[model samples]
Target chain A: MPSNDKLFAYNLGEIVPLSEARLHISDLSVQRGYGVFDFVKVQQGIPLFLDDYLDRFYQSAQLMHLEVPLSREELKQVIADLTERNQLPEAGMKIILTGGYSEDGFTPMNPNLLISQLPLTLPSDEKVAKGIPIMTHDYVREVPEVKTINYSMGIRLLQEQKAVGAEEVLYAKNGIVSEFPRCNFFLVTHDNTVVTPAKNILKGITRKNVLLLAGRRYKTEVRDIRLEEVLQAKECFLTSTTKRVLPIVRVDDVLISDGLPGEVSLQLLQDLKDLEEAQMTSPKV
Target chain B: MPSNDKLFAYNLGEIVPLSEARLHISDLSVQRGYGVFDFVKVQQGIPLFLDDYLDRFYQSAQLMHLEVPLSREELKQVIADLTERNQLPEAGMKIILTGGYSEDGFTPMNPNLLISQLPLTLPSDEKVAKGIPIMTHDYVREVPEVKTINYSMGIRLLQEQKAVGAEEVLYAKNGIVSEFPRCNFFLVTHDNTVVTPAKNILKGITRKNVLLLAGRRYKTEVRDIRLEEVLQAKECFLTSTTKRVLPIVRVDDVLISDGLPGEVSLQLLQDLKDLEEAQMTSPKV
Candidate 1:
């Protein structure tokens, strides 16, 4: 028998079941793909780093010229209420802000917020331990920083990435590998310095946290990262909401160093976990 | 009393009501805006230039690496059936090919094709006589030729365009005004040479017909079109499926010569309408 766990969807101002949550076909979100979204992880019934997620979400909305229908505090309350209703100690919440339904398309009108929760799908321990291979694709996102619903270039090469036995696709512009489709990447120099591209990439929350934590003890530098430096580096890793400090063993179909998970990546992964655990154990927000 | 009229939505292989067509929230088309679409103008219950529309639609899908689930003949048959079922003497049909829903959102799967018909909204003679004003935005579409669901850049400037009292947004790369967001732009030189940007613009079916008709009577050149040339040209116009030929009287807060519709634009509009009338009178394809 299947479990009777009901998933909740916060559509506009109403909380409905996931199946009942639907936007009209005339909505700009569906018609012209005008929308912005952000994902936040929940732990032990507490929404984690929701403020940061909302910050990015609102930032994306501003960049896309979409107005958030609800106030920031109201949105926060909605997420908290949804988390309480769902009662999932460990899950992920995705908040979407879309351009509202309109007969005259391409004009900004009222905005609709659709919030949904899903079971977290983090990178497995084994996958993280052995590290994964990534292929390089020469393409740049239209708006590198704003997390819009435009991913045509990134996802169009999915089959090719799978064909190469690659777990992710890394994007490069003019021989500079900046970021993957959904994550931020970093490098560990031969001399033990940690480096990541400072621009032309979305500033991932996990990446920001890792940088803050690592700056306390390690030589951390956020600057321009060329493809040559990535290939010549001792080790490299990637960071995102679901996948934290995922070591990259190979890039561009070539093994990095000895084709093993780097020491810095392992240490940073543990560091991030400890930080997350502390945040989870702290008083509920 | 309300008249009973049922609007049909072709969702993949199923023909359902327009309201009944719903793609999953996790579908790549919704999540990542991975899709391509084309619009066809129907006249007197006949689907006009559907072959040309489908060719461009397929070309866009191919450019985006999206595979249409149905073959050309099958899709054509479905379109014909849908048109016949609707029985609208004059209408506009929009066909959308989306990246299917998946457990993993990025990869392209079995495509979902959606076809919807809407009452035609064409350019009026009075409005054409007092030609439209357009504003130039300094941005280029990521894929200028492909009709992908990436209109964020175009739509984000909606407010700015409205502030300037502009009807549409024309995109420019550097100083070359390539095309409008939804139409192909053209200019007629002082020497009566009709010129349009050969590349970096969607090859609209109407544009092709206009070019063919004009090339026979006038010296027509399809080449690079600069903003300076557009401002200096004797006449300016744009073409699309719904709007056959629209004369552009003003651009970038500057009034064109005499601030009125040009002779070439008027002639081309009539010529294009004659061609359409011939096509309509010809045997149904």
Candidate 2:
């Protein structure tokens, strides 16, 4: 039992203290790193784009062959319950489904569902305005579409990223650019054309919303973006649940168009904020 | 507290029941799948080639930027204590070091170490004698040299492997065969030369021992092995702690030679047994 002040989490159908939400050693998430997870942002006691996140969450689970124990409606109810119990309006909700305790530590048996809410702090306005530098590495994620718990490569490169003063890694393969480790990347060409890689990315909800919003105003294209074109782009930015249209001013040693936040990126950020505000006020049914 | 009959595991600095060894949901192993693990085979109360396994384990942790909390000698003592407490003459020992409870669920913090001894059942002699069929996929593991807990791709392909009547997956990039999901691949060429992939592999301890044993009697080469060469090989096999030298009779729909276990594979299996016997009697210090 924990104090009432402790944060609560939905753990395998039970609302328990976050500290008490533990998994046994036999779970494949711990043993084999076999699991998929999706994150949603909650604001003003409302989950933003919950349906979109849920849709991708189930798709990722299906691709990974993990069966979600609860139906979509039941999962929504659990999230609502957790949100009410935790009482954290501005928090991040993580829905994780893992290959359950295995007898041989290889096979996926009964799956385990763990939903946790934690405080999420977005980048400061000053940081977002200045943007961040990114390092490009020639690599590709395995099962790029499935949001599995496998981030070993990106995590392993943290030291190198820090050494080079780069905050994120943009993956590229065979001269074509993909997404950042945790975010979808978009670049504005010199002619103000917005482009993003269509293949080999974990189509982020924020990216989706940004694409929709940007499509209404800008000429958008989802195709293979080469590294050479990224350097030539007038503006560049990344999108994710945590980083909603955050700009990338530099790629490696090269500055992205004078190393300043581009007009298109800043506008898209405002557009995403407007969308979030509307969703928060209306409260999706 | 656990009953005396329960299996014991070394969690962090303390020894506890295996079932009681649990990690919070915030662990990177669960949150981000950021960790590395090495498996060792214990024969008659002795962990075979423990130094080799530990060397590789440390290498893996280093590559992943994970600082192992215990020194090599301390880890050896923990393994010895676990072996004594479990009283299992023949078993598999798993050493897992995960990015500990992260404050943000993304970064690696104080690593958590979990050491557990589990009952291991090797493939029956009959099964090994007849060998198994494997399906080759055009995929490569991220960080192929590190034994990280990122087997999601292989695990996801389990259903397809079963449908195709293949016991394991042989991963290849382009047309070059790297290794199996959990083993190092080897092939006896038509000219009776032993060959294995030199790059992009975990370099299994069993593979190391087999290479040394086989080199004594056969011409051996460690270089890039292509799928065409594998299909035309006189013999094909895989080596791991659990499967010392199990034969692979077929790759996808193509059978190797007569689709039967070859003589060289059988001889190497005998050689591996002899080496294990020596290791069991004369434990490395």
Candidate 3:
């Protein structure tokens, strides 16, 4: 069992044992939906793409009228300390800031800061090689800019898709393809142009990197990708902090071009892998 | 500060310090809004209407596809022990059940159970006597059947309303009266008939009791009351577990019948008080 033996969390101001990082039942973050968070992967003792992820986190907090309790530099130091305390070279770090303890059920005064890491074992080479299936759901991510704690719709939709053996749930509104509940969706049009939903989806760090890398290496276009067009795309894929560029060979029982990873998706996945490898092995800064 | 200093909470079958009753940061309850809860008031060292609250809690858990980690009897015992440990003669008790920690962030196992209490000072007679003015916001409660943690709309609307100098926010969807973000909305028509919106409102415990009490006393009517009609109602009121029955003398700057508590609202409030006073003070077996 990969347990907290190797897990250390930054609670409030200090890096502490994971067991000590607890939330009082009175916290509005728990009683009400008043918290924001971000997850970044670590490799070779370095937080991958920290700057971009932090920017998104701050954007989300601003939308919620929550001030980041710590300065960006202070937060960065804490992340570094958290990594040092956990003694991990490769893991996934989640930074959660909750509108902390409040006797007033709806009004929160204290803000909680919790940073923890978990072991990461990316999918086997074969799983990524064959690509994965996705199911569509009709649910809009509220405060999509901020990684808010209230993710009931996303979680339930994911569970329903997983129950039917799908890898993800592609959420849509008004028959237009939004993005996966947790990942960003992209498609390669027949004209060899790569397409993705507009910024309405989570401005995922990995999604941004994938787009930049793909544009640098191949022809691409980011726009309002409709569901009907997505169903007929030459290739479909998803991007996330953890799953960098995963191919979506099937969307709901519809075979995405003979149920195989599209040529463009495979190339983009390789490009993202190359980018990650360069960053992970980049000289210490 | 009115703290429940003696309040003990049950954390995984062990009685722990009230302050130490905590859940892991990754608990789905906090990570995702995949948790359900119940809040009930304790009066004179006894949990008031606990059975009814617990029944609703279980129903909420089931609706969220979560299993209450304890048997009904076990939960009751935990509640009893929790109340005893807290030594709270009168306080607010809440039970939170989250589909516990998970690696995949989707599938959860070993749901976490948290119980805590805090001294709640009910509004003074002076405040209730003056009644509360409210503003209407276009919003609707999600998963009205289950007390899920995804209450951002409810909490945010209330906060926004408060910013505008309103004590509460009444939500309406498509001109139909929904509910107050935190409480249930009720009105007394000009004909001495009590009425409230039937659908899309939390079947609040206090609302149920008030309805029953009104039916027994004033022939209350339960129907879909539109927002316009509610705003123009001769008398308006709100109900919640803690508030019991509070008069809404004003809505959106409009005085509800000369900005005074309506005759029917006043009658129902008295009826609710009598019922609360009639409840047995002794702990039930």
Candidate 4:
């Protein structure tokens, strides 16, 4: 067993070693891939945006019709317990609620919940500054607003994406740009306005915070973004739990205005870090 | 433990009790819902259409980039061993191959193979004669050709479908009829021509056999089917491993023709049974 196997996880109602966190083969998560998940970043023993993540997690479960077995306060307590047990200040907490084991493989039954905390390493300053390349695929996710455990298309395209040195795949449909596989996309227009696709996206907590920060200094527009507009944008960036605010230097082979991370994206990243620092240092409610 | 917990299943490479067959939460199937599966019907100790089912299973795994750890012959042996151990004459065998345990939770690692045999009870004669009602939903499956474990949309709509007395949901996108949640849709025109959707379908083994049998007596067309045409269809039915050639009498609020099992569908169902009987009686290939 690996050393990380010693790490603890919340399985069903019991806290067990990560290695022992197992699910039956009949689970819809295994049988029909029917489940929803949410990730929360743990910074210095603090689960960042816990309320927001929990709200989205419960909403996702509701959309998928998999009732979360725990109440809001109970779930928060579980997360708090897991955080203390794992003893990892800098980590990611993955909460999964699956359509439980069904007598027949097709029906949704009592839900099974599993929560695990794992080491999370954010992008280095140099890498974030240099930015990453992403490839666009003409596809749209189903039930885009809900963060379900359905990432087959993105995971399947990993090989093809890696072949071109792209770190992510941006989903687009009918020439309209959407979100990336795991992150939300943002564009800085030539007029310095912030634009991001409004529909068909799993609105990320980081993206929400970034939008809040960007709103303070720039005119932010949430609407459909065209691929052509993206190509002509002054800057591009993605926001996620782990990728707080990473710049995107290139989309496919086209450079995002001068083939470098733009000033606006860099400024947003710094602002996001400042916001995080404030949240981490502020007194709890 | 449940009484069925005593049943055996093949997990990874070991044959274990079904209750003991579990996967780690880190598996892509659990974390990302990345996997493919195929079901085969077994009768009288023989797996019907084993070759065709195996071919499709491998094809699904290939399309999902999940390498089936066992070769064709090895898989056949595993199925045979499972059949012998389970000692059930009438059953459904599920073959699942998943993007295995990944370190990053997004990457596809070494695949996991799970084979399990479960008791299968086909629809009663009265149920088949009366036919089942299905609701039409404005949706299309992602990667419809591959038999992936992604059935979130279908399963989530179960309650709504049941609320309207629908046994299944027929997915139609932009007025184009594709397929049912877990079966293939077919129609018989007023002129006696048999038609089934050619694109965006799983192409079930039972559908293939029924099409072959129908072709022997009727003009068969494999092409796009529209919702407008289905309402005018002389007969409507579905084909699946367990369903065989079950008729569809009522589609939403509209009934197909006289709202009774059409002669053409009943004839095809009989033909399919005849074929199955012959296969069960024939010597091993």
TM-score of chain B of each: 0.95, 0.97, 0.94, 0.98
On the 0 to 100 scale, the lDDT of residue B230 in model 1 is 83
Question: For every model shown, what is its TM-score relative to the native structure?
Answer: 0.93, 0.97, 0.92, 0.99
Report the TM-score of candidate 2, chain A only.
0.97
**Deviating ranges (above 4 Å) for candidate 4:** A1-3, A283-285, B1-3, B283-285
lDDT of 1 by residue, B54-139 (tens): 89999999988888888889988888888888887778888888786655555667777888877776888898899999998777
Error of 1 at A83 (Å): 2.3
| Candidate that would win on lDDT | 4
Q: Identify the candidate with maximal TM-score.
A: 4
Give fnat of each prediction, in order. Answer: 0.46, 0.70, 0.49, 0.74
The lDDT per prediction is: 0.83, 0.91, 0.78, 0.92
Q: Give every collision pair in model 2.
A: none
RMSD, one per candidate, in order: 2.8, 2.1, 2.7, 1.2
Best of the two (1, 3) by DockQ: 3
TM-score, candidate 2, is: 0.97
lDDT of 3 by residue, A1-285 (tens): 126665778877777777667677667676776788899998878898788888988887776667788999999998888887777767888887777776666776667777888877776779888999888887667556668887777665555776889888888877878787678999988887888888567888888888898898678777776788888988899998778788889887788878888788888888878888887787232
Q: DockQ numbers for every candidate?
A: 0.45, 0.57, 0.46, 0.69
Please provide, for model 4 over A1-285, each residue's C-alpha lDDT reduced to its tens digit, 9 standing for 90 to 100.
224965899998899999888998999999999999999999888988788999999999998888999999999898889898888869999999999988899899999999999999999989987999999999999999999999989998988998999998999999999999899999999999999999899999999999989999999999999999998899999999998989999999999998889898989999988888887998263
Interface RMSD (Å), every candidate? 5.0, 4.2, 2.7, 2.0
